[model samples]
Target: MINLYEVQETNKMIEESNLDVRTITMGISLLDCCDTDVDKVCENIYNKITTQAKNLVSTGCEIENEFGIPIVNKRISVTPISLVGGSCCKTTDDYVKIAKALDRAALEVGVNFLGGYSALVSKGMTDSDRLLIESIPKALASTERVCSSVNVGSTKTGIDMDAVKLLGEKILETAELTKDADSLGCAKLVVFCNAPDDNPFMAGAFHGVTEGDAVINVGVSGPGVVKRALEKVRGEDFGTLCETIKKTAFKVTRVGQLVAQEASKRLNVPFGIIDLSLAPTPAVGDSVAEILEEIGLESVGAPGTTAALALLNDQVKKGGVMASSYVGGLSGAFIPVSEDQGMIDAVEANALTLEKLEAMTCVCSVGLDMIAIPGDTKATTISGIIADEMAIGMINQKTTAVRLIPVIGKDVGEMVEFGGLLGYAPVMPVNRFGCDAFVNRGGRIPAPIHSFKN
Candidate 1:
């Protein structure tokens, strides 16, 4: 049972801070949907999604209304289609059809985004995986709500240099294909290291083979709630702030666990993980950067911000782990530049830079998310950013990702509005220094030593 003081503090956090549940993701495995015939496979894919996820949005809305807590996104993650399409597709066109099927299913189900239009090429790419990656640009340009991701590196498998190189080319292709659409296609793609299959977040979620046939995963968010809690102890020392955040996170994640368990029971699906990430939206109060500012930083990129973020991430995880049996995904604070108003302000004020944002990614949840760079930024630079983040995740053995958008024809300080949940981002500068040699090396960075144990 929760204590009265704790409940009061939690409510106070929600009242004062920007607090709301970010996403309630349902993971539906599609391994059983695989078939030798392309049409049958597509049919199975559609049937499985529509059948298993029919109640997802309605249930999420019901829970939101019952608890008075907003659930920002109700999403579905399925088995990586590359694996499912492996036996069926000999050419890239087959992959395109699969992408279309996914889009149709998502539209029918009224989901905001459907993930697992992805492939895990960390170790190596199968023929279908390569074909799927090759067709991403066309697939993304043709589809509406289908998000894509590629795991090019992991702690155990090391980095797949060939896949990384191909991904760089794919990024360039994706950028060019959707250049006219405000570069919206790139917004749907993510490159990850140590990516999790149970992740309910967009642009980088999939159903891992280890998961059950169907499950319910919850991603609870409350940056505003955390900020409000910190504001209550405005003049308090750092120790008190950390304590406050941990206590608040405990309550938030507890709600998430309860909601997830109930949803799973109601849906007759297994209970999946709770991703305790402070995923912010473009709303007024739901900003992760605001949480940092409440901790006394003048702005998000100010000095000592990283340390503060480190503490917040750690405490959120600590509190969340204690609250639930299974805690997974990028379970920390998300600082997507365009999605958070405070982050956008920080970027416009020159308080944040690409380099500084990269630095912050080292301590927080995801890396280089929703960042819009000049359209002319070289593919090598994009790859360089990816390599740098992958190196960080590789070294730390933690999950980190890059979801950057090269806004075509947009220069520094310019804004590209994606509208809706994607929001808008100011065009940020990228490293002018040519990393041609480093990225051109075009060889796999071997797995870390830590991965070799046993």
Candidate 2:
């Protein structure tokens, strides 16, 4: 089945197309580690995580070397700390302690990041959920390599306006606390609607209660590969364009499937899924926006951009599904502004706005990711942005998320650099309109009529 040309083609994809395994994530369950005593729970967590992920880093490296493929990161995701510490953590300080423990474990395992400091409060917040929401500011500010997320809406539960409003204030507080770092803490936190449990990507990944004790998930990305394939069909009809993308996606996802199987067997853990998302990077040629342009769009955010994105997203899924039976997570094209170089350029050109980006999310994986806004923007306005996004996901019954970074002391056109994968972005201006009254009158927005499936 494997031929010399196939081998050569794959090598070219890695060597030039910037194709690589974005992450090999080990998801460990911390449900059994929960204890009524906060410190005791921390000890259990640190022990369990370190023990389970001890070989994760080395295994990832071994695979990369053997296959001659580049694996960018080896990471870990665990049961939500909110659930693990909810019963015992009485204050924000208590939650910060757990974050520190998680950070320590990540350092020991040699993984760059650890996720699942999260709470799910789509309909209502429990006492513990409220505690975790309040603690996010201090918890993220104090820890390194620990990523957090909160689910504030879902198709079945509707939007939790109470949590959304609180999160706006908490996001501002987090920025203030980490102002010296260019409000870098907000980059590690994500707010979501219909957040996926099996996502291998960070800032949103949490080992859900539905998962097994341990598993391995692989996220594959290849914007450059897709772009290169499209070049062969330049000026092609829409029919030709769709086929080119789908065939290219099939090849990209096959690599991910091989990596996932190898990791699961080596770790003696069950294999989870392959997430074939076209996640772009800050690197010049490795951009999803470039792929859109290759498909005939002058620039992303121009009219027809959404239709171009929709075609790409749908084809990626069609091709990927046939390659792997167990495909899950946010398996579509990602449009994170800061992380993608083309998006940054689009924003700089004034071709893209927050409102237009919101429309794109209707077809992309996540919404408002790594987007930097002016520090002077009001919390109420942030809440309004989130409410609109949540409404989109809730109605469509799809997974969507928001990760807006409000840069402290930075106004529009000012740049904030978080470097590395978090990249840098110019602070965009938020509309100076008031949404205080709507955000302040907090209550749950009832689930859509379609949610009554059972």
Candidate 3:
């Protein structure tokens, strides 16, 4: 428990291997803020968020300085706005007022991003849920530091085709509303199947109704650390490769445990789970694709790519569980095209396509993330894509999400830049096909047979 060598090794991992805590997120419940008047609802949300997260940023900075470990972002997540404003928010504009209030509170508290502008309509949509879903394009276009997500499917409730079809149009509207910024608003909106309650990552995080009033969740990432460890066992057998990744993951997660404990104690909040995802960045050598390449793949979309990803995802979870008692969220490998340089390179080389990426999500942490498509693509096609991903999550009982941006005034082979951690992406081509007849058949897809285990 008291050793100098372990501390020194952690420092080396930080300095050379790009190891760091990705986010320290505070999940604040807004259920008590509901009111009959829209104005009062907004006031309660603003006051609660600002008062609760007042010291979040400063505490994160203090931890970074005292421990010499970099904490990338301090953020917040709240109860789904649809539930919080159900009694008061009568119209789309009323829901958007709450969105503005959330953005204001985030700015005042000095957090990087605030999530939970969301509705959970897995089976069907209530009036409040429909209003919030309708307000997403305006809500995201009008706010900064506020992110939104909608859960359209779950293993128990099955998929909601109505919500999927509606969100297809809303995503396109969001792209048009923020076209001046390269359709950046859509980047802040995500559609999920089996979305987790305690996720600390942006654009998909929400404080589930099952959570306590307020808690602290930390997300830790270290793709570079894993890659460097693999290099040491480059020519070794499969058993050696697996062991190295497991041991390396254990060490990296310990650092996250330290940071989460410190942040919780200092902020007077209960400690939540640690999300040990291999979330890559645009920086050099900090890529999940590079890790796959290190695992002997020529490129990310080659014949054996999905197998390598499946192996990497399983091992990451195996070692992460051993390191922490409470491991939750999407705690596996992420394959965002824009965020990882190697993935971007693969796309430029015509090695990765949308179809291959969809196949990969069957095993990866999240599905079809941070991908840019052409503007002229039809809304039904987008809905079709969403339905396909939802089917995967529903069948496998895993959490999967889609964050697609139909960048306006751009086509395939063109580039769209979303600077600073939300990296740039090459606009990938989508299959020119029609699915209007299928998505228009608007009803829930019944849950799979295994879901009736109860």
Best-fitting candidate, scored by lDDT:
3
Candidate 2: tens digits of C-alpha lDDT, residues 1-454: 8799989999999998999999999999999998899999989999999999999999999999999989999999999888899889998889989999999999999999999999999989988889988989998998889999999999999999999999999999999999999999999999999999999998899999999999999999999999999999999799999998899899999999999999999999999999999999899888988998898888898999999999999999998988899999999899988888998999999988998999999988878889999988898998888899999999999998889999989999988899998888988878898999999998999999999999
| Model 3 per-residue lDDT tens digits across residues 365-443 | 9999999999988999999999999999999999999999999999999999999889999999999989999999999
TM-score of each: 0.96, 0.99, 0.99
> Which residue pairs come into collision in candidate 2?
none
Q: After superposition, how far is residue 394 of candidate 2 from its true place, in Å?
A: 0.3
Residue lDDT tens for model 1, 51-70: 99998888888887876666
**RMSD to the hidden true structure, all candidates:** 1.7, 0.7, 0.6
Question: What range of 10 consecutive residues in model 3 has the weakest lDDT sum?
Answer: 235-244
> Which pairs clash in the backbone of model 3?
none
Tell me the deviation in Å of residue 149 in model 2.
Answer: 0.3
- Model 3: residue 415 alpha-carbon error in angstroms: 0.5
